[model samples]
Target: MKSIYILTLLSFFVIVINLSSCDQSIDNLYTEKSRIQFKYFKEDTVTQGQATVYRRTYFDRTTLSFGMSDDEVQEDTAKIVVEFLGDVSNKDRTYRVRINPDSTTAKEGVHYKPFSSTQTFRAGRRKDTLSIVVLRKDLGTSFINPVDYRLTLDMEATEDFNLGMKDGLYTHLYMNNYLVKPKWWDGVGSLMFYHPKKWKILISFNEKWANKEKEPFNFNNGGREYFEALRNYLEREPTFDDETGARIYIDRLVEQNN
Candidate 1:
């Protein structure tokens, strides 16, 4: 009978220990740390030599090329979206971005404006954008080649939040001021060379394109006429090529495809 009583007490203590352990596991499961990451990615449709497939490609790096702008464009803004990965709160939260000088070639005040010491994530918001003002004026000879300036940004932990994913902890942005090729350059037919002086003149032909930012790069004119008209006009009234010292009106038809 005494042995039986001892076994009963021991079993009761064992059950209590298991229940306490289970409660701790439950508490740990409910607790989660807040996290934030950059929500930037590129998507592409692959249909060549295979089935049609849609894929999302995430990038921790991208180039901030300013080649498409007209001569008057001095400063451009880059919008980087940061995403919150936790439940929303009723109070605002702040985050920090540190620069890695070893990997950064762009000067803070010259190539790009410095980021604020802290950026705010408003209450009830799940996403916020970080604006980086990239300065292009007075670049001097630094922009003679492509990708002359690069800036690396890193995420830092703070009282309000913790770093999210390992892969999204940082990003790199490269900058250049050269009048590099635009995306729709091929749609210009086969007669133009992309010269800084010449591109400014070509874009002027369209009144709707006065605001280069709103300019619809598409060559469509409701089946009426558009890029071909620009070609015809240039062919008839050939401007002396100040860039090459040869009139492109005649030379382009035989020599250049900008």
Candidate 2:
């Protein structure tokens, strides 16, 4: 019985050793590689935007509040993480990053704060993150001109690490603070709701109203009450019956979301 117990303990030790070795091998697989690039599926959080539209290569547009009070507006930060292709290194590695704006329309300091020109990936680590803070006050436009600002991030490899992919070496972000006319919007001002209900109302509207443009409508800034009322109204009347005269009584029935 003692011999059997000893044999079982030995087998467990062997299994643990094998598992540890496997984990080390897997870590080395990436650490030993000469490549480093952007990590995929990482999300960016925006406090003032409704949606982030990603295009073929990079981000297409980051929607911003059209008109909201100071309390409603929050600063947005984009955390971009880059990963090393190989196993953890003994020595710390540092890479250079360039944050270049496409035009002078959104000047630094006036429109947004400037980001550091370099980011370091500490030694023995597979990934490093760079944070780009977007100031809420900078995302505004004057009545004379309205335009979106484009910010691009370019990553360069050091002697220790090679640039992983050509396509992912650079990424772009657009900031648009102006009120956007939803493609689905009729000439008349209409309400847009959050998901699920928005989809249901849109489908119903398409079948009945036959409006060709079906893009999700934009909520008026500071229209949280308006948004809730529109959502509730859609829940009750997906068909948007003219007889109910929702347009006439919407403002009285709604309260602010905040």
Candidate 3:
């Protein structure tokens, strides 16, 4: 009977321990950690029964190059989207953003136009876009070669919304007017552009000067001057062509562009 009593007390203690552990597990399961962050993708709807997975498409700091070869008529701009990371609230949330020149290479009026310092996420809305336009005319002669001009956007904490992860706090934009080698430049070469021949010639000529010139040459810094010099060099046709011919076949076209 004493053994039975002892067993009963031990059973009760074990039951209490299990119940306490279960309670702690439940508390941890229900713990809500709400956060707000920037959403990289523009997907408006999540598929039915699909888990909500966040993919970071935007970078904390990224460089975006605008080639001088881009269509003159098309508007040039970049869009950044910010969103909530946790459960949505009943009321609309307004988030404030601050844009500042992160690097001296780019200026507000010269490389890009200023953006509004604030963005809003409606009560039911998941994300909002911040657009920054790149002025092509302003880009031509403003930046120094090889140096990247950067624009930074900082997420500000406000009563309506709180900042979330590290990525949500800041984003960067680096703009330049050089002929940017596309992401697939290695596989596809100059075929990515509409005018492949012109692109090839320009790329070929630039590569030549980059390899042989005493001073480093780049299409972004003094591209206007470099191309002008190339044209003149072709025209003069120094006897050195027979002695030290241009390495690239495109030099013939460069001399003929006149």
RMSD of each: 7.6, 14.5, 11.7
TM-score winner among the candidates?
A: 1
Q: Report the C-alpha lDDT of model 3 over 117-222, residue by residue, as the tens digit.
A: 6666777666666678876665542222344677777777777766787756777777765554433323332222222233434455676432222324333554
Q: lDDT of each model, Cα atoms only? A: 0.68, 0.56, 0.56
In model 3, the worst 10-residue window by lDDT is: 239-248
Model 3 residue pairs with clashes: 145-221
Q: Highest lDDT: which candidate? A: 1
For every model shown, the clashing-pair count is 2, 8, 1
Candidate order, lDDT descending: 1, 3, 2
In the range 62-153, model 1's lDDT, one tens digit per residue, is 66656666568888988777876677878989888888888998898988987785888788888887889989875532222445577888
Which residue runs does candidate 1 get wrong by more than 4 Å? 1-30, 42-54, 62-70, 140-144, 184-189, 192-225, 236-258
Candidate 2 lDDT by residue in tens digits, 117-154? 76677877878776666666667543225567666667
TM-score of each: 0.64, 0.46, 0.53
Ranking by TM-score: 1, 3, 2
Question: What C-alpha lDDT, on a 0 to 100 scale, does residue 170 get in candidate 3?
Answer: 75
Model 1 lDDT on a 0 to 1 scale: 0.68
